[model samples]
Target: MNAIQFGEPVSGKTVSARVSPAGGLDILSRNEVARLRDASGSGLHQLLRRCALAVLTSGNLSDEPGTIFEQYPDFDIQVLQEDRGIKIELKNAPEQAFVDGRIIRGINELLVAVVRDIVYISTQLESGGFDLDETVGITHAVFEILRNSRILRPQVDPNLVVCWGGHSISRDEYEYTKRVGYQLGLRGMDICTGCGPGAMKGPMKGATIAHAKQRRKGNRYIGITEPGIIAAESPNPIVNNLVIMPDIEKRLEAFVRLGHGIIVFPGGVGTAEEILYMLGLLLLPQNQEIPFPLIFTGPQQSAAYFEQIDRFLRLCLGDEVSRHYRIIIDDPAAVAHAMVSGIDKVRNHRLDNKDAFFFNWALDIPLPFQQPFRPTHEAMASLALHRDRPRHELAADLRRAFSGIVAGNVKEDGVRAIAEHGPFVIDGEADVMRALDDLLKAFVAQHRMKLPGGTAYEPCYVVRT
Candidate 1:
């Protein structure tokens, strides 16, 4: 948290800043540095700019990705190869990220992480450093990205918990997440999430207080995100460590590989996508024996929400799939106790199998799930959502269906695609389609599709029954 030396503040909503590396990475090659500032269409500049802008304007409530960029149209960022090391050059950046003419330390650290990850993935992966075609290659790439970001630590037990839910949720559900997080923190567990507001922010918020009370050190509030969704759900400042994966698939893989257990709160399509992804992984015959704790919990008011989710899951994946997760309502202490208990089993399993404490190397992530899914109109229509296929395969398709809705709703490309092509048409089994339609309707009725203050949401997709 040293005093920052940034350019003179401008009079408007933007300011000029130069951020030195606070953590993760400090040095970079000249070519890599150049690409970071390249303004060409294929260069990393635009990707860097949009993602960096999202981080600068942390705590934004808009689910629309383009809104923030429109506000700071002239905002830009660059990386400089300095004699000492690397320095980030910011022009017309959000002034809110600064405090008394200096960039906030936590934000600066996260900014460095964003820059570090972007540069690493762009330079190394693009140069064929990691083969991403196969499942093993993809898993290795995720591991390397995490290791490079310094997110993986040795000699640590299985205590990191991943919490997933909508960026926009009701106040009661959000409070419930915090209560669960406080109890988890008191038991010395770390927190990971998508790094946005609502459910994502709540757990970290609660954990901080609990960590302080317990005099915890090196408390990890990790936020894993991607470029496409950064604007829609900006990283909250409470996130001490942030890793921007190459894509949503990689981001989701990072969650399962890094977290010892998972707790899901009520959310819209994005949350449903996560639940499906987890179940799909566990349902695999190879992964059936893996002890991955999954729990869905919320306030009492959201009981029907989980019930609907449970029903949809059963209709799609069959009753046996219920073994993969537990649905707990209105009991924060009980949820925490369950997570701790599950993680204990995880610790034992990892020990008996000789797996690393930081990474779940034994868990199997299939090629279908590892590959990035482009939620195009055609892709949406081509999904195999019928029950004739294997349960895991069907789960994967359902996950993709929700993923498309998420993209169309928030991600810049998905939003633009929907605008140009109209709502995506999801063709699937009649029963499954009925279940999905009903569940999505519940999300909309509960105002979970978008932030409460925004305009009423028009669904970006239509399921063909």
Candidate 2:
């Protein structure tokens, strides 16, 4: 690969080069190549370009997608099909993605993942390869996407732990997440997350040291993201294995299906959305028997955060929702121990049910949780957030409410929608709306809604009784 310096006066230094696929997407059909190269109103090139930029800009802190695009407006990528293999051409790309005119190896692999998933989803999944209407079909599609990424192992025991939390968090909370990760890593556990900074990076960072001390080989630090959220939360530098699902619902599904346990830290609406999604599934009658481990933890200072979450869950879904998870405060060792013990139970449960260790096929996720939610103003306004619905149903709608808030806060389309329209109007039962308003007020006051030190946050949604 050679860097071709261009004469473009830009804010940051840009590089142009052609790099071959490191270990993915080595071969593609003529049609596939054409689809990737097609730069029209109806093609995959724009999507490919956006995702590729996100991979190249790994470790970026900005949650706004437009900022990155505006910074590198001249940046472009082209997929060149050749008999030997495929070559990706970068133009005016982020200079940080390269060193001394050579692309970073990890970044290169992740870039290839961008190309692979974008092409595969555009050609295969969206083209009748999977029946997305059925719940089983959706689960199968998630499994296939993960399987294609080659992260799933057939002979491994249950050790993967998924960590969820806000990208914006306190230094103390971040350190606590790392400590918990250190303990988990010393016990030979792998880590998976949304693949951004803050809590997501902390566990992987701490685990690296522990993994080295224990001489653990082939350790996986996986990051799963969707197109809508990837630009806002680029895969952190520690993410060795990154998979881009088609959307948020599938992304969340992949997390639960692939992970043996989960640890949730203090976070904002996005984190709450993840918690509710998991709880919604667990509340289902069929999932009651499954041995899945869920834990909510943080530093002592953040105890009230989890308490508020607990209260909101109870208020929205009833007291029974508390049975599905345990809260541990300021005890990383205990958190790791609980996860280790819980994973053992998960292993036995899978074996008893004749399920695969790499993927939890026996977990019953209802269609509501599997379906992708498009959070338009009308859709957000019409959510069935009343307590009269079933607990699972209410949890699903509540999850959607938070999901829409996340979109408005970060995702490109949602931000644009909020700009064109006003804040999303969320109406529910009087008590539920009051509880939600209180919880959201706490999040805003704690600076959980956006990266700390940014300008004061404006509400993205109005909760109405």
- Candidate 1 yields a Cα-based lDDT of 0.88
Best by lDDT: 2
Residue 338 accuracy (lDDT) in model 2: 98
Candidate 2 structure quality by residue, lDDT tens digits, 1-465: 011111122246799999988997779888888888889988888888888988888776677657779888999999998778899999999998888999999999999999988888777765799889999999989998999999899999999999999888888888898999999999999999999888888899889999999999999999999999888788887888999999999999999999999999988999999999999999999889999999999999999999999999998899989999999999999999999999999999888888999999998998989898999999999998889888999999999999999999999999999999999999989999999999999999888888744477899999995
- Give the 10-residue window scoring lowest on summed lDDT in candidate 2: 1-10
- Compared with the true structure, what per-residue lDDT tens digits does model 1 show for residues 1-465? 011111222233988988787877768888888888788987888888888888888866566778887789899888888788888888998888888878989888888888889889987777899998898889999999999989999998889999999777777777888999999999999999999888898899889889999999999999999998887888888999899999999999999999999999988889999999999999999998889999999989889899999999999999999999999999999999999999999999999999998999999888999999999999999999899999999999999999999999888899889999999999878998988889888888887787766476889988776
TM-score (C-alpha) between model 2 and the true structure: 0.96
Estimate TM-scores for all models.
Answer: 0.96, 0.96
Candidate 2 — which pairs collide?
A: none
Q: Candidate 1: deviation at residue 62, Å? A: 1.0
